[model samples]
Target: MTLGTSTSPLHYYDVSSVDGFNLQVSMVPVGGGVGCGVTGCETDLNICSPSTFE
Candidate 1:
């Protein structure tokens, strides 16, 4: 689903169940946006993000 708004397009991610016990999530920018550290902008998550931006 679209993580952010259509106008902003901050992030896009997919979600699914893993082993019927846990959740699996993967995210990337809608177009071409900066990641975790980008001067005035930054990204945060309760768990973790991939090593690479993807």
Candidate 2:
């Protein structure tokens, strides 16, 4: 998603696999301000065993 003016603005974004989980995804904001940092799923959910959900 986008925030602020188009000329000079801030941006917020992340990778999502809501419908389905394929490859691992992550997001790291460089030189970010407060509350801005890395976010994502580093795990390989595709190969996870059913027991893992328990």
Candidate 3:
């Protein structure tokens, strides 16, 4: 399984407020169990702080 999270550009600078947006994600599954021949897959995910922008 894979996982990830989206980031906002407004986070770079100190802004008063902003509108609304969605954190969209897309993935394409491979055929069969053909992978890197490893036991399992390695995840490269980004963990974002929930209360950072709030």
**Global Cα lDDT for candidate 3:** 0.32
**lDDT by residue (tens digit), candidate 2, 1-54:** 456587877677756666557566777777778888778887877677365442
Q: At residue 19, what lDDT does model 2 achieve?
A: 55
lDDT of each: 0.41, 0.69, 0.32
Candidate 2 residue spans exceeding 4 A from truth = 1-3, 6-10, 18-20, 43-54
TM-scores, one per candidate: 0.22, 0.46, 0.18
Full ranking by lDDT? 2, 1, 3
Candidate 3 lDDT over residue span 1-54, tens digit each: 532337532211121223322233333444534432223213322234255554
Local lDDT at 40 for model 3: 23
lDDT of 3 at 37: 29
lDDT of 1 by residue, 1-54 (tens): 555676895654444333321233344434564464222113343236455432
Candidate 2 clashing pairs? none
**Backbone clashes, candidate 1:** 0
TM-score ranking of the models? 2, 1, 3
Candidate 3 local lDDT, residue 18? 37
Candidates 2 and 3 compared: the better one by TM-score is 2
